[model samples]
Target: LRQEYLQHFQAWAKSLGLGHSVQPAYNLPLGMQADISLVEAPELESLGFNEDIDLYRQFTGPAHLTGRNVISTEIGARRIGAYALTVPALVGLLQDSYAVGVNTMVIS
Candidate 1:
């Protein structure tokens, strides 16, 4: 059903000549929460940037698999407080996301 809606929306956008200009938001289930494994992983304590990289992979992997042109993430300073990351750590998160496959960041 999601794919069907995407296709229909794409066609509508194309008709309006806005297909290339607009990017869809591929939100993950659970309103942008990290996967449970990432939240609970013991190795996260020591993994540093690698952990961010891995989490970015998990975030964007599904969108890539589904042939999405623009992969996005809903992340912000407040949203990631549970991770106990510093400001530099948060920057690293965005960087890692781009390094993997996320082309768009939705901070909300």
Candidate 2:
């Protein structure tokens, strides 16, 4: 149903002389978080100021040197919305990013 609606909207928008292209969505697993603590400092230190490092460094500090851009799940389940947890919950959810030492986050 959603696809149909999008398709109809796209056609209508195009007919109105507006450019409309629906891009593919990026999907991240539900309940996943950044883990920034698992990385070894030496590995991060060894990274050169190359293109790869330039791309990664924008998102995190030495702890998050995975060289992979972090993309998050934009939508969450109702269960997540219903829950109320403490800082530990945030810590656990972000352990992966923490393992890699991500100091900054990019929403997209």
Candidate 3:
């Protein structure tokens, strides 16, 4: 991620009580719709949740029947890209889980 974007994200997360212990990962799934789930398995695994961490992974694959509550943390800004459009096309890879749908959740 660019330094400016990182600064914005870090500030936003800190204000919301998410600490720096939650490391940020970038550019996952290398083709299209990459940023939709940038903090994927590797990042999540590295977190190794403690009682206070409450770490969650972005959807990695199709949802299994194990009843895990999946959530999305997709946030974006206004720009000149198709992903700057909507949520579905952005997060269509992992098809069967909760989407936490947002057309444009944040624009800063």
Candidate 4:
């Protein structure tokens, strides 16, 4: 059913002269939270960034296999102190995401 919907949407967009496409969120990272509800420094520490990069490669394997070039997903949202994140820290987080094939991000 999902495949049918995706193809239909793609075809509809193309018919309307739009190049929009849909992709599953196969990113391998936390949504500004770890095992906890509110995100903080402690929660960030539990992120899988320290894990093997191969894990993420596998996580996004499905999208790659389907020929989807754009891997978009939400990040850096719902934090304990959302405004406390420094510029460098945010940059580093994005850098790590890029290393795992995150080209477009929806920062909330």
Best by TM-score: 4
lDDT for each of the candidates?
0.47, 0.33, 0.31, 0.45
Worst 10 residues of 2 by lDDT: 39-48
Model 2, range 7-78, lDDT digits (tens) per residue? Answer: 566568768977443211212121111322221111221112121334234334522344434322211122
- Candidate 3 displacement at residue 56 in angstroms: 15
Cand. 3 TM to true fold = 0.21
Query: Tens digits of per-residue lDDT for model 3 on 8-49?
Result: 765677789773322234333322123223322112221122
Q: Which prediction has more favorable lDDT, 1 or 2? A: 1
Instruction: Quote model 2's TM-score.
Output: 0.25
Which candidate tops lDDT? 1
In model 3, which residue pairs have backbone atoms overlapping below 3 Å? none
- What tens-digit string does per-residue lDDT give for candidate 1 at 1-108? 544554566567668867332223233333122222122111111132234566566545655554556555555435335656677866876676678876766543
Using lDDT as the measure, name the better of candidate 2 and candidate 4.
4
Whichever of 1 and 3 has more TM-score, that candidate is 1
**Candidate 3 overall Cα lDDT vs. reference?**
0.31
- Locate the minimum summed-lDDT window of 10 residues in model 3: 45-54
Off by over 4 Å in 4: 23-59, 79-84
Q: Write the per-residue lDDT of candidate 4 for residues 1-65, one digit (tens) a residue.
A: 44455456656777897765332222333322111111110111113333344544543444445
